[model samples]
Target: MATAAVAGALGLLWDWLWSERFWLPHNVSWADLERPGVGNFPRARHVLSAFPLAAGIFSVRLLFERFIAKPCAIHLGIQESVPHQAQPNAILEKVYTSITKCPDGKRLEGLSKQLDWDVRKIQGWFRHRRNQDKPPTLTKFCESMWRFTFYLCIFCYGIRFLWSSPWFWDTRQCWHNYPYQDFLIMFVHHLATIGLITFSYINNMVRVGTLVMCLHDSSDFLLEAAKLANYAKYQRLCDTLFVVFSVIFVITRLGIYPFWVLNTTLFESWEIIGPYSSWWLFNGLLLVLQVLHIVWSYLIAQIACKALVRGKVSKDDRSDVESSSEEEDVPTGNKKCPYDGSSSNGANQVNGHMRNNCWAEE
Candidate 1:
């Protein structure tokens, strides 16, 4: 207990020093209440304020899905065919853990020779072993549904709210707000979004910006819906939705977005706002978004080609595998985590373990 106390104190002190001295800009420390006064929040940490509302909404949605959506899905025969999942024994588990946790491209052929198994079997074990980290089908459903609901509502709200603003008529109002948000990658995405909205509003670029946001939101809605369908075992429906998603994503992101949005922000904005450093920052971030769009588009195309050939998609490539929503905007993350088969009794055990990565990879 005494050791723990000392360790805790040291850890806290290190955190304080690190955050205050190294993390903050100009070594600013949290030393004040920031002139507590009228129209300002109290000088107390109250980050909990937004959490409850979000929690309540989540709870209600979960409850509704439990009592409503899940039952409907079950009745309609929408279900995943869960084969008996297997767990690796300690020694084998250790091997898998080391490989996945910090892979160093150790030869699977050598591992296969060591285990007295085919290279394909070794590869299969590792693939499914890593897949074990994927989120379950139900969690994926709820997440996709939540995002679909949010983007749909936000798109509608953005349209309604911006219709009457002066920025709708003029191109210079967006410069007035000059909102500068500094955030990490995830928060940078949100900042970029707010930047897009604010600048579009300021520079009378709303006409193009609003359309881009709507197009993005629309594709997002379909993407999430497709994931929900995928989880529900509605392969046909999932395929249909994915096809539409691919089509719209291509049309909007590749065609309309690059042309319309880039023209307005990069070309037209320069004409109105004139040249500035921030313009480069703004357009640079926009290009970052475009790069992401193109990368995801490649995945979409990858799947589309498979669909054309096989009439359906049965698996995904590792490159597109997601561990969390931080890597993507729509309903994407780990899919169903598969595992290895159990060994048979005694001497024949190792020989009888399942030995195939049956799913085709292109």
Candidate 2:
């Protein structure tokens, strides 16, 4: 929290300088929060607009995924992984759960001696044990669908808001009257703005919140799109989006939000109104957001490293890959595998072995 607070503060500081928050409201105080304003549309009324907007995009994405992406995935030969026969051995499972997941050489050696099996078989068993943890295909589909909808909805909403609002586009209007000296609060500010928009819409702060959401949501489309593309087996397209997403993420999230928008919020708002208990709450929430971004940045760096050195794009590099060995079995080059086109009633007999092996029957 301390670290996050510092990060938020620094982010706001950057925003303050860039936004020129120092030049407004020479002697702003808490009393100013209640100062009546006129001419602004009831921000609360517009808050409800987000739900319908999100729903519309969600519908479109679902339709597209079902009709387009699923077919595309099938055409490109990417289907669900072949499920391994589940072992219901309670004692063996208990050993796997209580002890190290991947046993060390000595432990493996001991286990092999006890089980009267080779070390390789023990390793393969452990691999299958871990494989049991793989999520169901439906679960992955739903998760990806949720992300796809959220990203698409947020991106479209952001654009709609930007198009409707002249205040954001007109630079001459901003900092026309302000005072400043601030740290970055861009990340948490958006989160709080969204909360406030949903909860305290009457506060008339929802417009600011909307703008914050817009700025941040800018890069998210590419991130989710890349993952969806990967799932659809659009590997080349996914690779391109992954690269673009990284650049956009750095530009929008790491660069502009903290330096530009946070400046507007932190330094500008403080001068307009004095500190309240809610101020503390708001800042604290913002700090939490900054911490999350920093954490995700670590994962993003890993992705970048893999892209640079390994020359491949990964959707979820943050988590350990299920089985690097299994993944590696697909080969390292741009070499594509030809799908064995055996119909439902038939099996592809490749090199005298049935290629469409079903281990689940075991």
Candidate 3:
């Protein structure tokens, strides 16, 4: 904790000493805060001198790099290995071989089952590959470009907000003839706008992706649950609720917010009233949408958890059946050959405890 505190203090000190040199005009000075548009630095000396604020900001970046990014990379690596690792199982191998030998509708169902992934996900991958073969889809490229622009805008706007304040500016005193309080407010407002847009975009993307994955999983659950008299109605209700709430959250996060931001009449009102007057209204709506999203996410997670638990229980039961029936099994030829029907002997090879299955005929 002490070390973290030290690191944070150092970070803030570093920001104080160098931030102005890099971000502010050379002509600006500490005295500029006394000007009309500038802010008062004298009043912020105590808070800016504290250790907590600096530590908090530095810790966030540290947490992202150390906890989030590393874990996400590991998860992605594991996911990438799934298809290769599962390739040797006879059922999986057959599905793989069929997919590689066919195209479009001919392979869709087999590939979908083999991959244990949604058809939409497989279609997306195929679309991405096809787009790679060409110049790339204009719409996708434009969206990516806009996303990059938005990220850049948010980053710079945040920096501006931090530096514009008297509390922050007093440390380095950058900016000439600018009042500290007013410019600080403007900077904060801009930061808020950028943050809102970035968050909205991310939420929209996650909501859409989640909804698609949920629909696929729900379909599978419905089919499986139909075989169990007690589970069918409950599963159907869960699926319906998930779809409905997910749609609502997506519409609010993506459609409403973007529409509000883009509307000329709204923009004019916001401009006339100023950010201070409109901040509460805008942020309030976002807060409500965020709450709805949280609720939707919770529902989805609950359904998934229940499904996973049931699947594990079913798998255990199947394993018991296989074990109990082992002594009564009929004699058969090589376990791999007739089941896989693979021309290549390589399909029978095992890596560790897993069988190899390829999505293509080798």
Task: Give the 10-residue window scoring lowest on summed lDDT in candidate 1.
Answer: 353-362
Q: Which residue ranges in model 2 land beyond 4 Å of their true spot?
A: 1-72, 105-110, 136-142, 170-204, 291-295, 298-302, 314-362
Better of 2 and 3 by TM-score: 2
Badly placed stretches (over 4 Å) of model 3 are 1-194, 197-277, 300-362
Q: 167-206 in candidate 2: lDDT tens per residue?
A: 4764223333321211122222233234433432333344
Best of the candidates, TM-score: 2
Ranking by TM-score: 2, 1, 3
Worst 10 residues of 2 by lDDT: 343-352
What TM-score, over all chains together, does every model reach?
Answer: 0.55, 0.58, 0.21
Residue lDDT tens for model 1, 1-362: 99999999999997864353332223223342233442222221232333565566678778866776666556656554332232464645777667573223366556666678655445455555555665555544555566666656665665565566554345344433222211121121222234444333332233445445545655666666766676666777877877787787778768877876676667755665465544565577678778867866676666665555767645322211433333234321353432211111111121111011000000
For residues 122-189, write the lDDT of model 3, one tens digit per residue: 54444333323332122222222332233344435444544444423232122123223232233222
